[model samples]
Target: MSNYPINPSTIAAPHSQSPLGANISSASLTTEQEFETGIRIIRDAYRKKIATKDAEIDALYKDLRRRDAEIQ
Candidate 1:
């Protein structure tokens, strides 16, 4: 509300947008970049692991078919 003074110190911070006070500090930007890099690394590792699992599944299916044919 316009009647409330924007208090930055209070732990009960209101999620209100202020044109004058909404400035990102250098430290905050650095921290955000680091977070993004960490997220990217984790995502890439997960994707590689999934691809490896898919390849293993394909190999297993092929082997199963070969064994089935030998039994027939």
Candidate 2:
């Protein structure tokens, strides 16, 4: 499970108008983009981890079956 919150409530509100409104908007956009990238990276990592675990489980099961066959 991801520790990162994907909830909308956790997202920061885009900056409101100010003297640096343009700069703030640009920065906010960058931050949001980075956040999305981070999520993708984390998600991919988890997928790889799951795949590796699944492969390990399958190998173990195969080994168990082989052992059973030998016993018979």
Using lDDT as the measure, which candidate wins? 2
lDDT (0 to 1) per candidate: 0.69, 0.72
Can you tell me which runs of candidate 1 are displaced by over 4 Å? 1-29
Candidate 2: residue 59 Cα off by (Å): 0.3
| Model 1 local distance difference test score | 0.69
Each candidate structure's TM-score, on Cα atoms with residue i matched to residue i, is 0.56, 0.58
Cα TM-score of candidate 1: 0.56
**Per-residue accuracy of model 1 over 1-72 as CA lDDT, tens digit each:** 599887867754354433322343433344456566567778999999999999999999999999999999
lDDT of 2 by residue, 39-68 (tens): 777899999999999999999999999999
- Model 2 clashing-pair count: 0
Residue 30 displacement in candidate 2 (angstroms):
1.9
Error of 1 at 72 (Å): 1.4
CA displacement after TM-score superposition, residue 39 of candidate 2 (Å): 0.3
